[model samples]
Structures are given as C-alpha cells and as structure tokens.
Target: MTAGLSRRAAICGIGQTEFSKESGRTELQLACECVKSALDDAGLSPADVDGLVTFTMDTTEEIDVVRNLGIGELSMFSRVPYGGGAAAGTVLQAAMAVATGVADVVVCYRAFNERSGMRFGGFASTLTSMPLFLSWYGPYGLLTPASWVALHARRYMETYGVTNADFAPIAVVDRKHAATNPDAWFHGRPITVEDHQASRWIVEPVLRLLDCCQESDGGVAIVVTSTERARDLRQVPAVIEAAAQGATFDGESMTSYYRDDLTGLQEMGAVARRLWSMSGLSPDDIQTAFLYDHFTPFVLMQLEELGFCGRGEAKEFATVENLSIGGRLPINTNGGLLGEAYIHGMNGITEGVRQVRGTSHNQVDAVEHVLVTSGTGVPTSGLILGRD
Candidate 1:
C-alpha cells in the first residue's frame, strides 16, 4: 500500500468575504481580500506563500493573485476543474505539494460575482461541455442547473420511492444552521418543510426553488502548510487526514447521466473508497460532515455514497434530529450553499476548517474529524479533515 499524504499537511487558516448578492467589486479584488485574510489568520505574509491553487472557472488567474498579493516566485500554480467538484481537490493539491516538497504554504481560493455578474442559475449556450446532453436538453427547453439535476432526481426518486418531501429536511436544517450564521446570506431566514413545499417549482415535479443553491457573490480562501509547520502558526491546524480526488469512468463536466447506475454519485463513491482507506476512518468516526449542497437531493445521495447510511436508506436518515447540531452527524453547519452563498463549494471547505478549529457559529461538540465533499453527479473530490 502507498504511504498516502495523510496528516502531512494541515489547513492553518481559512478566510472568506461577506456573502452577498452584489459585492460591487471585481472578482480579482475579492480573491485578494480573502487570500490576505487567510494569511493574516495563519500568521503568515504574502511572501510566505510559494504556491496557489484555484478552480478552472474562477475569473481571477493565479498569476494575477501572485502579482496582487506581492507573492514572490511560486513553485506551484495549479487549477482544478468541474466547478464545485474542484473544491476539496484544491486542498488535495496543496497537501500533495507540501508533502512532496513541491512548495510550502499554499493558498486555495475561489471568488466570483455570480449573482450580480454571470449567473449560474440560468442556462447559457456557452456551456457546451456536455454536447450530447445539451443538444437533447436545448431542443426540449430543459435548461438551468435545476433541470440538469432534475434528470437524475427523477430517476433516483422513482427507483427508490423518494420525493421532494424526502429532500426537505436537508434544506430545512441547512437554513436552520444558516439562520444562526451571521456570515450566511440567508441568515435569519430559516424555512420549514411547509415553506419548502410551498416554494415554486424550478423543475416540474422534481426540484423546487428552495432545493436549488443560491447564486452568490463572494470569495473564500484556505492556507495550507506542513502539519509540523502549522503547529507554530497562529491558529490550530485542521489537519488533512486524507485528501483525495476521484473521477470515475464515463463522467462529464456537469452531468453523469451515462453512468451504469443513475441513482448514486459514483465519482464521489470513488473518492470515498480512497478516503476511508487512507484515513483509516469510517463514516462512524466522522463527528460531523459538510456534504456538498449545490442541490439537496445530492446531499441524501452523499450520505449514502459516503457509507454513512445504506443506499436508499437516506430517506429515513435525513431527519432534523439526525443531522442537526446535536445529532449523530451534524452536516452543513454554516448553512451550506442553499443557506450560505455558493462560492462554488469553497465556502463549505472554510466551514469545515472552522468546525475543526472549534470556531464555527453552530459548532458541533468534540469534533475530532469532519468530512467535506465537493460537487456530486460529475467527477468529484472529498476530504477527511481532523484535529492535529
């Protein structure tokens, strides 16, 4: 077996800008703001940074970040793709860099003006990534992310006797956590199952408006360094117990429609296999979790895919008493994408760091390890974070 990079690196600091509909600034400014904030939190300066990582979709380039931050020559400048799937992969990249001596002190960031700028909620012809699906969907007026996810939701619900009601607890508890998080854009706006049922349908008979995540304008960044080095830094290190990125066969950019089984996140399943093997930890060991909430149905799929519950058993497992702050496994305590602003899942990583640091607004007690995932459906990645 390979000596994986488990506990080789740790997230020394996490930072984010305020979640808002309109930041009234360029994406570059937002990126710099969060990176600087993260460095400040890590007791490091811009010059201490030698590596940088980000999403392929981010508007701010790596060189731009280096120039703006006055960071010197970088040994590593990499980008991860597949939108939200790249969230945890960024840290995976940084952990590898630090472990292999590629660089020291890396910062992973995602910043966007998605709401006041280019919105991801609505469909755009520019997204020709899934050519075959786009051709079929375009002619049938099936546009937007909700409709794309609706394709899988329909099959999942039909195959497993699931419904929109089965998905409401995730949305309800997410907003409930968001209601307490002051940084959450939807703070103070907790919703009930009745409210979720009353919301308008974004995709008929499948997804409601509340089931979809918000198109937010914000930025979040994480500072990574060797675990030994992190101990001397300003804050407690959220150690990288196991960092993994997985992309199974027959996966596309935004859709995994052609997979043999349309009911589960197979790529995330691939990630889970690596995580468990590397960390030597199981679902039972996870104190809390941050399953990607770009959509709520995927949250259920994630619970099953990660082996927290058996396949098709999430319908019974997804209760407020189960997933709440005092439950068997609290999830998305910072409200998640549905409640917090979607920095394309980067904000979820920051919250995982917070939970590990014991600084979260809805902090779970005795959190020895926190499981954080990237996007579902397509090629995805996940991380098992723990206290160092």
Candidate 2:
C-alpha cells in the first residue's frame, strides 16, 4: 500500500500549556511557553524557527530551547526515545525536517514538570544506572508504570477474556471526552461504570486510579512546514498524511519482557502496519482518534493494534461505540492520556493538530482524517492527520 508520500508536511502551528498538576513553571519555563506558543501559532517568530524536535524524556534541551527561544540558525535537531513512545516521533522528526529541505520552520516540543516536578509515579531504585538491559527488569518488580502495565494487563486477561468490565469502556470513554474538555484534567470530571468500579486499584486485575495517566505539568508544540509552506501559514493546514515509527522484535523500553504476545501491542502492531501502509488510509479513513491513553489497558491494546478492533475485539469495540461524544471512532477527543494532560505524548500531538484544524473541544463531525498515537507498551509511534 505505501503510496501516499508526496513530500507533504503541514500542521502550521499549535501550542499548549495549561494542563497542570502545578505548572508553577520550569521545565525550562514549560519549554519556553510551549515554544512561544508554537511560534505564536505560526504567524512565525523566533525568526521562523529553523528546526528542532524533542523528547528523549525531555527536560527541555535543543540548545536549551534554542538559547531560550531567541532562536536562530539550527538546520535540524532531533531526539526520540521510548518514554511516551516519542509522541508521533516528534511529528515524525518535524516532518522529516520539513520534507527534506532539511528544516524550514520545524519545531516540535514537550515540556514537563510531571506532577509538580519529576514524579513518574514515584518509585525509585535508580536501577543502578540503567541499561544492562535495564539491569534485567530493574531487579524484578519491574519498577513502575503500574508494574509495567500489570505485566501486559495480566497477559491481556489470560489471552482475552479481557475484563475489569472490559477496561471500563476505556475509562468511560476518556472521562466522557474529559467532560467536554475545558483542557481536561478530567475537566468537569466525568466517569462512571460505577466510576470505573470504584477507582483506586492501580494494578490488580490490570489498573485503575481511573486507569492511570495524569501527573502532568505541561507544554506542547507543533509547527512543521512545507505543504506549500503550510498553505500560507497561520492555521488550518494539518497535512502530514502519514508518519510512523515502530519496534517489535525484542523491543523493551516499557520492558517488553521477552514477548511472545503479551496480548499484542507488537510496537503498536508495528505502528499500525506502517500507519495503514503510509496513509493510503483505512480504519475507515479515521474520522478522529488519538489512542495513547497512557494506561487504560493501553487503550484496549491500541484499538486492537490499530486495526480498530479485532484482536480480542478491543473490549467489544470499546463497549459498543460510545468511545465518547457520538462515537463510532471518536477517541481521546482531547481527553486522552485519560483526561488530557500527559505532556509525554505532547498533549496527544496537540489533539492531532486539533482534529486536522477544525479545532476540537470534542469536535468530530467531518474530521477529514486523524489517527495520532504514541506510548503504548513502548517503542511506538503513529500519525496520519489530514485535511489538506
């Protein structure tokens, strides 16, 4: 399938910050205020950014946010490691550095305070300076991340009986689209299925503290140029029709623990079959989605590894539609990372550039296309975005 690449690269700008646990600032001032509000929403400044991409568990660096956003000359910069699976591979490394001219506007960011400052669910042993294959599962307890997603949600509920009320309809459809998304930190707090069977578990029959995801501070950014300079910039572009990153065999960043099939994520099914064969589109042309809910059973194992429900039938297609707000597909409407605010997926790629720029709060009506995924049992990435 892979036929779509025509050197496109859009998403002219998008920014974020206010999802907080306490952004009393500094993760380099939430990465220079989300890279100066994504270069003031791409009316361009910081001298039209030269290029930068982020996340190797970002702590704000890329020449210190290009010497604190007084940006100038940087042809290209990059980073992408497993945490939150490098959120759409930082806009696929700024759309392959602006579709190969090697950088024009670029920028892609992430910032963090992660719950007032470094808390990744606090449980440290400092794995003896990691990497010796994470010192064989950091001395067995598999450290945190809810016990490495409760060992693949207990082998996907013993090879698919998938219960805990089928992952409580993906945390009740991401807190019912984060209760109408007032930049959701469970904005207006929605949830039920008896509030995910009376929340709090954290890792028993798979997870709960509302099925994880929080501890945010904030920062998000986007820009990436070229689709004819993002059709004369300042918004509505969003194109980059496909981008992927995958890692399957022996992949480990969230500890793959010698996979055989811990209920399928196979690096997001190898980034959803290379993002539906490089965006020649499928999954019914994606009218909106954002997958990486950070925990909620890896958002039903990434909707059955992005074929949108079939492996174990993604908990019966997320309890018969209601994937929140008039759902057939509508996911993470901006309340992902289970109720929006997990800088690691860069605010779900800024809500997939606001659902291809029709601008979302929970808007999913005609959304041309929009897949956006990342952070699913590690070594993952995906993106599709559309509306050119």
Candidate 3:
C-alpha cells in the first residue's frame, strides 16, 4: 500500500528566473518573481497560497516574499538549513503541510544574488563565531568550499584508486547535456574529457574549474498541492513518491570528514534507505536521477550511496553514453548544476518535474520515476518524484 504522504502531494507547477552571474536585483525581488511565476503556472492567485518553505540561508524573509507577492495570510512557513543540502527539505516540508491539511497550496522557494551579492565561494575566515571544526581547520588554510570538499575528494580517490581520468567523464557528460540546454550557463559549449584534464586546478588532485558548479545568481520556486487538487491544475502532476532528510552520526555541515569511510556519502545513504522504503521503490525503479553535482566527486559517491551501483563502481558507472539522454538512467537532463544554473539544487527539483511531465528540453524516454538528491557529504535530503 502506498503511504499516506507518498502519493498525497504532487508538484503542480515550477518557475524560475534566468540564471546569471549577476542578477542586479535584491534577493526579495528574485524570490517574489519566481513565486509569482510558479503561482501563475499553477493557475493559482497569490491569495490562494497558504504555506511557504525556504532555506534558512536565504536572505529574503517569508513575510517579505509573501507580502511582495500579494500572498494571503499563511498557515504554514518553514526553513531548512545547511545551504544546498536543504534543497529537497523545502519540498518535503511543503508536502507534509499539504498532505496533512496543515495548509493548501504550499510554495517552496530559494533565491539569492549569490555571485554578485554574496559569493559563497569567496567567503573565507570566520567573520563571526566559527564552526568548532572550522576553527580547528580554518587556520590550516582550509577556507573556501572547494578546499573543504577537496579533503573528502582526495580521500575518496585514495580509497577507490580513482584517477583524474575517472572523474573526467562526469564533467564531459554534464557539459554535453548542457550544450543542448539553452538555459544552461555552459549551454552550447560541450567539453571533452581532455578539456576536463586540462582545466586549471581549483584544489589539487580532485577538483578543477570544470568540476565545480557555477556560482550562479537566480531563484527557483515550486508549487505543491494534494494529488487530487493537482489533477485540476494546468500541468501534469509530479507526485511526491517519497521525501526524506537524513544526517548520519557525527554529521557536520560540509566537512563531514570524521565519518568512517570517506569513499561514500553516509548521510545520502540514510536518505536513500528511507526514500526506497517510503516510496516502495528500489534503485531499479528510478529511470532518471538529478544527483547533486555541486562537485563532481560527490556525484559518483551519490550514485553508490543511493544504491544505483555498488561501492567502488561509481567511477565506472559514470559514463557519457550510460548517463546521456538515451542512457539507462539519464541524469541531470536539464544540464544539472554543472551545466544548468545552480539555484541551490531547487533547479534539479524543477528538472525532475519536467522529466515526469515529458516537457524537458532534454527529455528522457519513458521516465516514470525520477530520483533527486541534495548536497552530498553533508546533512542532506532526497526526493522520489514520479508521474501520477
């Protein structure tokens, strides 16, 4: 039997602003723009919305967005933490609200002028109070996000005997997909494995400029309602099969190096287990995946943790032909964060919906189940979305 929450909620609409390096607008403005578009897509007036979910790190407040968008009084509002890791949690929270009747017509959104306003990659030092772990590691020159993820990426390579060549295929395939996606920042500009090999190093031995996701500026918003109500909406419903958040023991934000094995993502493993159980679907059920690719190495690790492939096999499983539009499990069909714009993984959720709706520009054939994971190597979340 399907769980009450599993098929109760469906994504009725998705909207976003153009991805860019500099939006030249306030975070509030961007948030409002996306929410307005999402509501319009759902054929909902702002007054019809009663719930809101967003990232804790988002600069715009819930009230600010609601007021600006002319949304009526809200019965539910929530915020998820841990930067990109909170992506799926936003929808999960909204689904919960809609499923239990805590609210109807929930809007989940994330917005920022990350590149032009506050660059996360450019952030260094503990300006205020430091994270206890960062205080210990920060002085040792572990400052930027690239350097932080590099620690785990380096250890993963050593454990699995993965080389730069193994990592090149991921970038190559993502860029290939992006080349066909006009909205992707790197669209129309596919790269070769040789190109990935030649890119300048961001952090030695693992990440290169090509491996890192764009520091983009934009917003994405999703509309969630009961599957029953969704059927009355304008678009095909992307039912929420499962939604879960997980953090393993001793879990830190991004620098979760204290885990037993750096070769895989334990937090993502927890989410995968719950998602499979809650959705009554295994790895075999997923036709496409929107694995978070903020960094390339984690994408491989996510494949392993999510049970798409066994441990130590992700290096080989990540191939251009194997993961392309016609591949068995086409991934990041909207070009992912690497190719498309990075709206802190919210864009991935949108792409998942597109795949289910058969409206993606890089549409995968016969897509019934789409798996999407948030930031790996951190306290993360995952969602299983499928056609209703």
Q: Write the per-residue lDDT of candidate 2 for residues 1-388, one digit (tens) a residue.
A: 2344433788788888788789786888878888898779879898788888888878777888888788889998988998888878888878877776888888888888888876877735443566565466656756687787788678878888877777888778777788888988878887778878888787787787877877878888887888898788778888878888888677667767676767777888888888788877889888878888878887888888788768887777787265766778878887788787777777877787787787788888878888888888888788888888
With candidate 1 superimposed using the best TM-score fit, by how many Å does residue 107's alpha carbon deviate from the native?
Answer: 0.6
TM-score of each: 0.97, 0.34, 0.97
Computed on alpha carbons, the lDDT of every model, listed in order, comes to: 0.90, 0.80, 0.89
Ten-residue segment with the worst summed lDDT in candidate 1? 122-131
Model 3: which residue pairs collide? 179-188
Candidate 2 local lDDT, residue 303: 84
Model 2 stretches with alpha carbons more than 4 Å out = 1-20, 26-28, 33-49, 52-67, 73-90, 102-105, 111-162, 165-208, 219-291, 294-298, 301-303, 307-309, 313-341, 347-372, 375-388
TM-score of model number 3? 0.97
Residues 1-388, model 3: lDDT tens digits: 3266798999999999999999988889999999998999889999999999999999889999877988879999999989899999999999999988999999999999988887888766425656576796787888788888889888888988987678787788888888998889888999998899899999988799999998899999999999999999999999999999998898778888776877778889899988999999998888999999999998988888898888999888988888887886788988888889889999999999999999988988888899999987678998999988
lDDT of 1 at 350: 88
The deviation in Å at residue 5 for candidate 3 is 1.3
- Per-residue CA lDDT of model 1 for 219-315, tens digit only, reads 9999999999999999999999998889888876665688779998888899999999999999999999999998889899899989999999999
